[model samples]
Target: MKILVVDDEEDVKSLFEQKFRKEIRNAQFEFSFAFSGEEALTYLADHPSEVVMILSDINMPGMSGIELLKSIRKDYPAAPPQVMMITAYGDSQNHNQAMQLGADDFLTKPVNFIELKEKLLKTL
Candidate 1:
């Protein structure tokens, strides 16, 4: 699976890389990183249809993940790639908005990799 992970914090790249090292090495997964919502959009635009899933942080400096999700759901209306929002808040409002905006799933911050892996397995 090819996944794009978007976050303002650069460390998220290393964290995901480390967490999914085994899958990556086994050629079961591929990953790309975007440091912000804008960057993620640019990447998606440039690579159209390459990414199968996106894991995005909700609160970023420029565009929030909810905004990003809305854009993605609009632009890729047919067979849209799955999007999962991750946030520190874990509030009901955020979760409801994301689902309403067509988010495929939601995860709270300090993500539990084991659960994430299980979710990925079920979906992918």
Candidate 2:
């Protein structure tokens, strides 16, 4: 499965790389990273059908995850890729907005990879 992960934090690339090392090595999961929502959008334009899921951070510097989710839903309304929004704050407002925007799932920051893996499995 191919998953595109978007976050402003550069270290997120390394974190996911390390956490999913076994899956990557075994070719069970392939991940791509984007440091901003615009970057993620550019990537989507290049590989529209490649990504199976998107894991995005809600509090990005530009183009928040909610905006990205809205765009994705609008652009791919037929069968959009599953989106899972992540945020450091577990506030109800963000959660509610993400759901209202059509997020498939929501996750809090300091993410638990085990839980994330389980969720990913179900999503796939």
Candidate 3:
């Protein structure tokens, strides 16, 4: 599966790379990235078919994950990528907003690798 990870943190990217590089090397998966929501949308516009899933950080500089999700649902309605919103905050408001904006899942920050793995596996 091809997965896009949208986050502002370099460390987060490195973490994901650490966990999935073997899968990528073995041809089990491919990884892509975007530092901001706008960048994520641009990548999607150019490679829509190549993207199957999106794991996005909620707090971004310009556009937030919820905004990104709404845009994806609006412009790519037919085959919108499955979005998993990740945030440091675990409040009900964010969770509701994410779901209402069309996120397929919501994951709180300090993310558990095991839970994330299960979620990705199920979605894939």
Query: Which number leads on TM-score?
Result: 1
Query: How many clashes in each candidate?
Result: 0, 0, 0
If candidate 3 were superposed on the true structure by all CA atoms, what would the RMSD be? 1.1
Q: Scored by CA lDDT, what does every candidate get?
A: 0.93, 0.92, 0.88
Q: Write the per-residue lDDT of candidate 1 for residues 25-123, one digit (tens) a residue.
A: 997889999998899999999999999999999999999999999899988887589999999999999999999998989999899999999988777
lDDT of 3 by residue, 23-63 (tens): 77887767898999999999999997789999999999999
**Which of the predicted structures, 1 or 2, would earn the higher TM-score when compared with the native?**
1
In candidate 1, stretches whose alpha carbon ends up further than 4 angstroms from where it belongs are none
Instruction: State the lDDT at 18 in candidate 3.
Output: 87
**What TM-score does each of the candidates earn?**
0.97, 0.96, 0.94
Query: What's the lDDT of the predicted structure labeled candidate 1?
Result: 0.93
Query: Which of candidates 2 and 3 is the stronger one according to TM-score?
Result: 2
RMSD of candidate 1 to true structure, Å:
0.8
Clashing pairs in 1: none
Error of 2 at 42 (Å): 0.6
In model 2, which runs have C-alpha deviations exceeding 4 angstroms? none
